[model samples]
Target: MSVVITQVFNGFSLGSILLFVAIGLAVTFGLMGVINMAHGELIMVGAYMTYVVQQIFAKYAPQSMGYYFFIAIPVAFFVSALLGWGLEKILIRHLYHRPLDSLLATWGVSLILQQIARTIFGAPNVAVLPPEWLDGGVRIAGVVFPYKRLFILVFVILSIFALYIYLTKTPAGRRIRAVTLNRDMASCLGISTRKVDAYAFAIGSGFAGLAGCALTLLGPIGPTIGTYYIVDAFMVVILGGVGKLIGTVLGAFGIGLVSTLMEYSTSATMAKVMMFALIIAFLQWKPSGLVSVKTRSLD
Candidate 1:
């Protein structure tokens, strides 16, 4: 029973982590319908950004090593956002209506990013050490929950709030969503569709960056680490329903819990195969997913 309780808790944490990654993918795909195969590389870039900050702090400001994470959050977001923006301007913009072309281009971009990382950071796994404040665990009723996971869970909540505010309340977000819902109408109403695209892409990339920062708290990271979860992230977004925030959240947690629990009784490979089989079966009934998002075309 204790083990069951522990696994459940772990499942929630894992799901939340997956949510951080999936939310970004959901937003980008929802807004542009671009299959961003390079999205995982953005996560890897954010993780590497955190690692860079750690190394910098360790060298010049060892006394403030504990504060490295606080600093890395914004830095990673900014750097990753820039990269995302650049991708949109240089590559993605050309393939807006060509979904297959976008997929291939981004897949190639992903390969390029992986090679770049290997060239700079090598083929080994790298990790970031947690802050002193995040070094402990809390045990309650015989269930031990790590502080880092708790911190990540809290981060997820805060991120959701921030994202909600951004997408629903902010002008820039509104412009992006407006463009996404009806590009012709939005442009007719004086919104710069191109700029909005750049902003949406940047914001989506920022979420992936933030996810990578949270991942550093969990375990060792490698260039391929993001790829390991990209498929799952896509699964969550697809299952949740594109562009439905609440649906994505529920879907991420559901898949996270089920996958974690299944891996316990079965092999990791089998758990993945079974989960995917389940998703395929489920999708056969509801091709639109758990929630249906309506755009101008759908409407």
Candidate 2:
């Protein structure tokens, strides 16, 4: 029973990581209908930013090293979001409605980002030491839960809550939703659809970046770190239903827990293969996804 509980907790922690990474991608894809191939690179960028900040503090402000991770979170978000904003203004904005072009362009951007990272940071993996606060675990009923994972779970929850508040209560969020539901109608109602696109893209990019920063607590950082998880993010989003936060939350945990349980009985590789097969079968029965956004159908 203790082992089962531990495994379940681990699954939730893993799901939290996926939730962080997928939220941005889900929102951007759902709202803009753009397959941003460069999103994983943005996650890499965020992890690198966290690495850079840690190094900066270690060299110049050693006394504050313990708290630098907190500061790095916002910094990573801003940097990644700024890059996303610029990409939209310069590249993505023009490719609206041209899904193929957007895919090609962003895939190229991802490669460029990977190369840039290699040139600047070298090709080897880098490690960021977790702060003292994240070094321990809490024990309950003979099961020990790591602090780092707990922090990530709480962060994911807070992020979801904040996003829910923004989307349901705020004017800017309403504009985003309007555009998500119907770009033409939103524009007709005086909402600047283009501006909303930019905002949504940036927010999504920022969330991925934030996820990357949190990830440094789990393992080493590398140029292609984000690429490693992009597929999983896509799977979570596709299964969760585009543009639905509740679906995303439930889907992530469901997949996370199920995958973890499967791993207990089979090889990791087989577990993923089985998971994909299940998803394929599930989608065959319901092509729309677990929960779809209600919008006006185009005739």
Best model number under lDDT: 1
Cα lDDT over the full model 2? 0.88
Across residues 1-299, which tens digit of lDDT does each residue of candidate 1 receive? Answer: 89999999989998999898887897888556889999999999889999999999999999999999999999888888899999999999999989999999999999999999999999999978978899889999988899999999999889877988999999987898889888999999999888999989999988889888888998888989889878888889899888788878988898889989999999989998999999999889998888896657644
lDDT of 2 by residue, 72-128 (tens): 899989999998998899899999889999999999999999999999999999999
In order of appearance, the predictions have TM-scores of 0.96, 0.96
Candidate 2 Cα outliers beyond 4 Å, as residue runs: 294-299
What would you estimate as the lDDT of candidate 1? 0.89
Model 2 Cα shift for residue 167 (angstroms): 1.3
Span of 10 residues, lowest total lDDT, candidate 1: 290-299
